[model samples]
Target chain A: DAGVTQSPTHLIKTRGQQVTLRCSPKSGHDTVSWYQQALGQGPQFIFQYYEEEERQRGNFPDRFSGHQFPNYSSELNVNALLLGDSALYLCASSPGGWNEKLFFGSGTQLSVL
Target chain B: DQQVKQNSPSLSVQEGRISILNCDYTNSMFDYFLWYKKYPAEGPTFLISISSIKDKNEDGRFTVFLNKSAKHLSLHIVPSQPGDSAVYFCAATYNTDKLIFGTGTRLQVFP
Candidate 1:
């Protein structure tokens, strides 16, 4: 079975520009969550989507947004990128609700210059 | 403030020794805890988890112990191998999809 998949394994964007990262959840998963991992640091939860609606969010600001499609695929959008925004964007998928085993993608590495 | 914390930024152990990684959380309401191991340039991979209801959970050579009273948890690896060396992260959640993570500890197993 196919696991979670992410696109554009690497990206480069300048400040004041917008970037979009895509993710497809693993088979049989119904939820998708986004996380950002800074160098030498653990990942921080960004947001989660279920049923195409954002069910929960973290401490991130309005500059960070996401979307979940009908097929359980997700996209993370960031506006006005900052140097601090340079991190590995991870997409995790779960079977259903919270506390379930999460399947993670390789992640999209974003370099905000 | 970090809800979850891993005090050790890195650790080294001789292969075949018992390696213990510790984690703590400030939130008493966190009901679920998980451990993830990551290799360089790769995403974190789920290792093992412990629910609040259970004090201990074991899988293969790995074990996790949870102490609800202290808001602490630990992961134990027996006869650790060199391949076991990786960055380990502790995560916790309170019945929500959001998981709070620690800074992570890099484990190095030396033969």
Candidate 2:
């Protein structure tokens, strides 16, 4: 089966510009989660989407938001981007029950200039 | 503050030797712990995991040991190979919430 897939593998934008990254979860997963991986740091949770609604969110600011389609694809939107926003954006999906492991996409590399 | 910490930023070992990576967490509520390995330009790949109910879990040549009382966990890779060299991260979760990850440790296995 095809694993989680993310589009626009790499992106570059100027500060104050908005960016949208897309993700298609694994074949059978229903829950989608987003994470930010800064240089030298591990991935940090941004938020999770289940049933088209944001179920849990991390300490990120309001500038970060996301949407999940009925087909289980997801989009992460970052408004008023800053230089610090330049990082790898990862999209992960789980089976949506008591499953603990997550299938992750290669991630979208966002570069803010 | 970081709830999970991997003090060692890098580790090097000869091939066919054991590689031990350590991780510590400050959150006592964390019950599920996992290890992930990542190559450049790739997302973290799940390696192994352990729950609070068990102190050890093994899968093939990879093993994870959890010390709940000390809030520490470790990953052991036996007879390490050069291809095993990569950045390893430790993560934990409470219930079904978001996973908190450590900084990561880069392991280099030399032949």
Candidate 3:
């Protein structure tokens, strides 16, 4: 009955540093997706992972990368973080494809200084 | 290129009134549209969705109307309650695994 769980509710990082955000999908869910939401903006899709492989990606740059493990857990990594990288990183879980209703985690607030 | 646009940044309505939130998209290929309700610190919750095949879908007091020709969609909430006040996000997908979201509209239902 537990929903998606995220680690390190809030984080602070300096410029040029690499940061990793973790997510554990809800029970019985197998797909994981990553999204970035800047202040006053809606969540933007970064990538989606299914069957332990990336199935689709958005218009994000190379610096933003993700990995899906066998357990349906996922991680989002951002390298050379810039000040603009400070935003809320959200992880969503679905039962199957993109069309399914996505259940989201509270999100990890990343602050890049 | 912002494919999805919610021109109104915010909307306010009185209790027991009807509140409508509008959304438009430029991509004609998008066939699936959805709405999400979000609080200040919480992640968005799925409100409702409509596929290309349907022009309208209703669930309780919330309804979604899709005008395919105009590439526009709207969410209507009746007898608005204060608890319904939150940021509403419009999202679209083209039968793919990715969704394009709009800037979102903040709705405030007053007493």
Task: Choose the strongest candidate by DockQ.
Answer: 3
lDDT of 3 by residue, A43-97 (tens): 9999999999988888899999999999999999999999999999999999876
Q: Give the TM-score of candidate 2.
A: 0.98
**iRMS for all predictions?**
1.6, 1.6, 1.5
> How do the residues A1-113 of candidate 1 rate in per-residue lDDT, one tens digit apiece?
98999998999999989999999998999899999998878899899999999988889999999999999999999999999999999999997755456788999999988
Q: What are the chain A TM-scores of the candidates, in order?
A: 0.97, 0.97, 0.97
- In model 1, where do residues sit more than 4 Å from their true spots? none
Error of 3 at B34 (Å): 0.3
- What number of clashing residue pairs does each candidate have, in the order they appear? 0, 0, 0
Q: What is the TM-score of each predicted model, taking all chains together?
A: 0.97, 0.98, 0.97
lDDT tens digits by residue: candidate 1, B1-104 = 98899999999999999999999999898989999998876778899998899999999989999999898999999989999999999999887658888999
- What does candidate 1 score on TM? 0.97
CAPRI band of model 2? medium
Local lDDT at B103 for model 3: 96
Error of 3 at B39 (Å): 0.8
Question: In order, what lDDT does every prediction score?
Answer: 0.91, 0.93, 0.93
